[model samples]
Target: MPVFPKISLRPEVENYLKEGFVNNEVVSASGKAAAERKFEALLNHLSHPPSFTTVRVNTHLASVQHVKELLLDELQQVWQFNGLSVPVLQHPDLQDVLLIPVIGPRKNIKRQQCEAVVGAQCGSAVLRGAHVYTPGIVSASSFMKAGDVISVYSDIKGKCKKGAREFDGTKIFLGNGISTLSRKEIFSGLPRLRGIGIRMTEPIYLSPSFDNVLPSYLFLQNLPSAVVTHVLNPQPGEKILDLCAAPGGKTTHIAALMHDQGEVIALDKIANKVEKIKQNALLLGLNSIKAFCFDGTKALKLDEIEDTEGTPPFSPESFDRILLDAPCSGMGQRPNMACTWTLKEVTSYQPLQRKLFPVAVQLLKPGGTLVYSTCTVTLEENEEQVAWALSTFPCLQLQPQEPQIGGEGMMGAGLSGEQLRQLQRFDPSTTPLRDTDLETLRDARAEDMIRLANKDCIGFFIAKFLKWKSTSEKDPQK
Candidate 1:
């Protein structure tokens, strides 16, 4: 049973998405009937959680086996329910991956006396194994006290005002929980906020919280995000570039993969986001990453004798590899009950992404790798960009990915079937979970977990290209 119905969207957004699925040539070619079915499946799946929860055991600091044992022990202690053991399985393909099935929409959880309203983002996090943080609490019962049992509701429409006495606007029931703080403590004077306001005891979805749980030995990252790092494959002793890198999830992963060897330059347009990158690097103990606040689209050096070792505006062919995880209309994010973006706002990312691509290509050494990826499902952002790139740059050729867990590229961009095969796309709607023996999953290998993790992920696209030896038209190689 689904806990939430297929996320309700504004009429305009719904019509826009429906037209894309019905009239778009790429979707029509997949067979109109099949396309419609897939769209429905996407909607259904979006309202629910993924089949497995992936945790990247920080093997850089702790051994995989050791972390696995510790996590199992912790799960037993934290998630004990009537002496019944909750299964914590290791991923078959990724060595560091740990999988835990979410037990959800519990049959019997009585509504409590007190009520706490949270915003949609906080509600989604609660569904996916996160405890309610202090700031997410929007409104609480006037008489609510510490340890009082309460039922949480998510204000999906984002219309609920903070510190309200009561809310009758739009909201959804999340689950039952116990208040960790009194109403006064949660809504009083400055510096009143100190700790967790609510502790979820009977969440609709049952998954262990990873908060402060083996922070150094494990990172709670989505499976597709992990795949992005592996596909980039940043090697040791090489200089790499990550454009639009913020909050430093992939940036830190790259540095860790390189064993903290060589320079990993990370750039983001926002100054505050750059600070977050540095903070994540410090927390992860990665010293090789150098993050700067600069726009990647304008990262081209015009001077003959520019500073070679500084941030951005670098000379051509400066990096061995570049990752342009460009921003886009994040329609693929799950549990998004509503999106207020206009069509114009949603279609505005392509030009910016295109502007950044050339800089990334010019900054790469001859024979260097450039990976362009996005967490989006739009044709304009994914396949169409690949088509445009191939036609624009004679030196660039789509290269095959090492671990191709996602489906091939979708068909609307005039790319050939073989060309599409070379690209990787993690379309959550297409892949289905396979049932394997319990014992087999328990003793799964690292490669198996990586494979499984790759397939079961958010909608994403990855296109890797290798620059030719030379770009000059008069070259003998040409």
Candidate 2:
């Protein structure tokens, strides 16, 4: 049963998503009832976190088994402290993935009047096993003091004003927690405390906090996000470009796959996010990654250069491979109880993605690979982009992805069955999580859990393309 109501989007956005899910192709293929059911399931799943917390073991530093042992030891301590136990399972397909089941919507979690309210983004993090940090806290009870037990709730509709005395608007209880700072310290203290504001003693969902846990050897990543790197299959001593790579999850993964022997150019428009990419690369001990703050849409240069150095705006077709994890309307993110995006905002990413696509194709060398992915379920961003690329770039040819664990591409994008087979879409709602208690989960086969970990992931889409034609031979009309 769904613990919360279907995700509350602006009425127009909701209708748009519903229509996309129940399009003519989907209805004709699955029947109207099944298509509607799938759409409803998606709405329900969006308000709940994924069942498994997936992490990628930095195999360059330690083997998967060694990392697993270390993580299990840490989890044991976490469980012992919290008076709870959860099984950690390794993926059968992904050599470097570790999965931990998330237990949720814990019944009878005691609520209190001393309430702490967090923003929607913060609440999503809390649901995914993060403590409520000071920056995320929107409000607290007027008299709420330090160390007082309180009930944490997410302002699902963005109705709670910052530092407000109380919020009565639509909110969902996250769980019971103990305040780390008094209301004054949070709202009025000089510079304000920046650490944990609410230590979740009883979260609606229980997962171990990964803060500073095996910093060098483990990267907390979604399962499908990790899959993109493997599918790219970067070889050692190759030059790769990651367009719009921040926090460097896939960039570092690409570097690790290449044994850190090749150059991986990571770019993001924002300077701070680029710094985060550098930081993550540094933390993972990956030296081959070069992160830059540059807009990817203008990354290609028409001027000829004698030699290609490691910077943006290089001569065209400089990279051996390129990964375009384009920005999208993130309708696929789980545990997003509500979104405040306007209809215009919801549909704004297609043009930006299109702007970046030509640059990605231009930067990729002949016979090189390019993988486009997004953490969203929009047809316009996923299958529609694929269709648009195929029509616009004759040099680009769709290729099959390795370890195709996700479902085939979604319908309503005018992609043929054969073409759609090459695309991967991980829709959480289509495959329901199998209910399991601690004992049953502990006794479950590792392979079974691995399968579950693959299917029941956040909504994601990936498509790999190969540049089989040289630029000279490319048709301008496409």
Candidate 3:
């Protein structure tokens, strides 16, 4: 059963998406009847959380089996229920991956005397596998003391004023927990923040919190995100470029896969996000990554000396592999209850993505790999862009992806069926939302859970292109 309603968007935005679904060729392939149903399913699934939580174990340090055993032990200690038993399973495709099905909207969880209100972002994290962070706490009952059991609620509409004594606006029950700090201790100074304010004992959705637990040995990333790094396949001792890499999730993974042997240059347009990339790289102990605040659209350094190294304004055809994970209107993200983007704002990313694609192609060496990806499900940002690239760049040709887990590319962008097959698309709506009432669905086996988890992932697209060697250009001297 669908636990949440269809994701709420502005009327204009909804109409825009609806038009795309109806008019798009791939969606309409089965005729208008099937297209409408698929569109509806997409909307419904967007509001609900995924069935399972995925953790990518850092195989560089600890083995997946070792981490799985440790994680199971931790869950046993944390859950400790007489009748309930939570299982941690390994992913079939990914070696260093663990999956845990989230048990949620549980029946008959009693409300506590005290109450604590948190933001929507924190609420979504709790549904997954996270503990409440200090900053997420928005309001608490006036007399709520330390050690008091309280019911946690999320302010979904962002209407709950911070530090308010009471919030009557729209809120949803998350779970129950015990307060770790007293009201005085939490709101004493001007900042009034320190440590964990609440320790969730009986969360509605039960998933293990891996915070600071095997940080080096395990990376907490979404399943689709893990697939992205694997698809890029950065090789050792090769120079690679991560255009628009902030927070450095994929960038760090690429370096790790290369055994920290090659130089991975990570660039982001924002200065603050660039700092975050550096911080994440340091945490992961990946020193090969060189993060900089630079516009990827202007990445090529024309007229620069060829001898110059380890600096900005890099010469054209410098990197062996390039990842253009372009900035996009993130419409495909799940559990997004509300989106405030105007139609203009939503459509604005196509031009920027187009501008970045040329530079990505230029930065790659002849016969090098270039992967273009986005988190949105829009035709303009995905298939249309691919069509444009093929038309504009004669040297580029689509390459087949290994471990093709996602569905083929959508049809509407005038690409032939053969051309569409080369692209990878993870569409969450295609998966069946398990019926809650069915005993088989409730008690699904581990293998079944893993399959569901993989299918029920965020909407994303990846297209890999191999830059063919041009006869006119001479080989570089070693």
User: Native-vs-model 3 lDDT?
Assistant: 0.80
lDDT by residue for model 3 over 251-357, one digit each (tens)? 88888888889899999989999999998788778889999898888777876656546666678888899998889998887667667789999999999998999
> Which candidate number has the best TM-score?
2
Best by lDDT: 2
Q: Clashes in each model (backbone N, CA, C under 3 Å)?
A: 9, 0, 1
Report the C-alpha lDDT of model 2 over 266-352, residue by residue, as the tens digit. Answer: 999999999999999888999999988999998888667544465777678889999999999988998789988998998999999
- Give candidate 3 regions above 4 Å deviation: 79-84, 184-192, 306-308, 435-443, 470-478
Kindly list the per-residue Cα lDDT of model 1 for residues 1-478, writing each as its tens digit: 3557776667776676666655567555777888887777676656665656778766567678898889888787775233445566675545566776555556578888789999888988887877787789999989899999999988888888999978999888888888888888888744756567888988876777888877777777777677777788889999999988987888888888888899999999899999999987887778999998998888888785877577777888878999888988877776566666778888899999999998888888898998998887787898889999999988898989876767898777889999999998777776553333334455676455555545555677889999985553476676
User: Candidate 1, which ten residues in sequence have the lowest lDDT sum?
Assistant: 432-441
User: What is the TM-score (0 to 1) of candidate 1?
Assistant: 0.90
lDDT of all predictions, in order shown? 0.79, 0.88, 0.80
How many Å off is the CA of 325 in candidate 3?
1.5
Error of 3 at 146 (Å): 2.3
**Cα TM-score of candidate 3:** 0.91
